[model samples]
Target chain A: EPEVTQTPSHQVTQMGQEVILRCVPISNHLYFYWYRQILGQKVEFLVSFYNNEISEKSEIFDDQFSVERPDGSNFTLKIRSTKLEDSAMYFCASSDLGYGYTFGSGTRLTVV
Target chain B: SQKIEQNSEALNIQEGKTATLTCNYTNYSPAYLQWYRQDPGRGPVFLLLIRENEKEKRKERLKVTFDTTLKQSLFHITASQPADSATYLCALVTAGANSKLTFGKGITLSVRP
Candidate 1:
C-alpha cells in the first residue's frame, strides 16, 4: 500500500525558532491535511489543502502557521515562531475520495 | 460547539473476546462517521467508515454501526487478539463528504493474551 511520508520523525527546537515540517502525500490523492496531537489530548485539525491552496483552517492555525504544496508533491507546514505550547505530534494525511484518509507516522515536534 | 466523545479512556479484555467501542457526537450532524486505529507514537490508521444512511458495515472481524437518529456509532472487533491493542479514534464529517474530519479523544483498548 502507498503511504504518506513525513520527515524528521523527531525534532527539538528552541521556543523562538522557526520550524518547517515536510510531507509527501500519496501520489494520486488530491486533498492533504495537517493535524496535531498534544500529549494526552485528542488529535486536532490544523489545516486542509486542495488545489494548491488552503481550503480551510482551524483557530489553532493562526498567523504563525502556514501550509504549502510547493512542488505539487511535497506538502509542508511552517511555524513562523515556535512556542512551548507548540510541542505536539504533527500528522500529515491525504485522501483520494475525502472519506477515508491515509495518515503518516507523524513528526514529534518538541519546542523547548 | 461540536463535541465527540468515546465511551471511556481505556478498556482491557481477554483474548478471543469481542471488543465493542462506543462513540457519541452532539451539536452537529455528520455526513459520515469513520473509525481509526493508532498505536503509541503513531498517527491514526483508517479502519472503517459508515455513512449516515447506512445501518451497519462490516469488514472481516470488524463491524461498525451508525445510528444517525441517536447521534452515535458503535465499533466492534470480534475474536480479538493481543495485536488488537491500540487506541481507536472516532471522527465525523461535519459537512459533505469532502469536508474535514473532527475527531474524538479516542479510546484505548488492550487485548490480553
Candidate 2:
C-alpha cells in the first residue's frame, strides 16, 4: 500500500527558532491535511490543502504557521517562531474523495 | 462549539472477548463518523467509517453502529487479542465526504493475555 512519508521523525528545537516539517503525500490523493496532537490531548486539525492552496484552517493555525505544497508531491508546514506550547506530534494525511485518510507516521516536534 | 466525546479514559478486557468503544458528539450534525486506532507514538490509522444514513457497518471481526438520532457511534472488535490493544479515536465529519474531522480525545484499550 502506498504511504504518506514524514521527515525528521523527531526534532528538538530551542524556543523562538524556526522549524519546517515536511511530508510527501500519496501521489493520487487530492486533499492534504496537517494535524497536531499535544501530549495527553486530542488530535487537532491545523490546516487542509487542496489545489495547491489552503482550503481551511483552524484557530490553532495562526500567523506563525503556514503550509505549502512546494512541489508535485511534497507538502510542508513551517512554524516561524516555535514556542514551548508548540511541542506536539504533527501528522500529515491525504485522501481521495469519500475515502478514509492515510496518515503518515508523524513528526514529533519538541520545542525547548 | 462542536464536541466529540469518548467517555472511558481506559478499558481492560481479557483476550478472546469483545471490546466495545463508545463515541458521542454534540452541537453538530455529521454526515459520517469514523474510527481510527493509534499505537503509542504513532499517528492514527483509519479503521472503519459509518454514514449517517447507515445504522450499522461491519468488517471481519470489527463492527460499527451509527445512531444519528442519538448522536452517537459505537465501535466493536470481536475475538480481540493483545495486538488489538491501542488507543481508539472517534471523529465526526460535518461537511462533504473525506473532509477535515473533529476528533475525540480517544479511549485506550488494554487487552490482557
Q: Chain A TM-score of each model, in the order shown?
A: 0.98, 0.98
- State residue B22's C-alpha deviation in candidate 1, in Å: 0.1
Cα RMSD to native, each candidate? 1.0, 1.1
Task: Give residue A37's error in model 2 in angstroms.
Answer: 0.5
Residue range with the least summed lDDT across 10 consecutive positions in model 1 chain B: B92-101
Task: Write one digit per residue (lDDT tens) for candidate 2, span B5-85.
Answer: 898999999999999999998888898889999999999999998888999999999999999888999999999999999
Candidate 1 residue-wise lDDT, B10-77, digit = tens: 99999999999999999878888999999999999999998888999999999999999899999999
Top DockQ hit: 1
DockQ for every prediction shown: 0.79, 0.74
Q: Candidate 1, residues A1-112: lDDT per residue as tens digits? A: 9999999899999998999999999999989999999999999999998888888899999999999988789999999999999999999999966469999999999998
User: How close to the true structure is residue A74 of candidate 1, measured as C-alpha lDDT?
Assistant: 96
Task: Say which candidate scores most in lDDT.
Answer: 1
Task: Report the alpha-carbon TM-score of model 2 versus the true structure.
Answer: 0.98
- lDDT for predicted candidate 1 compared with the true structure: 0.94
Which segments of model 2 are wrong by more than 4 Å?
A: B96-98
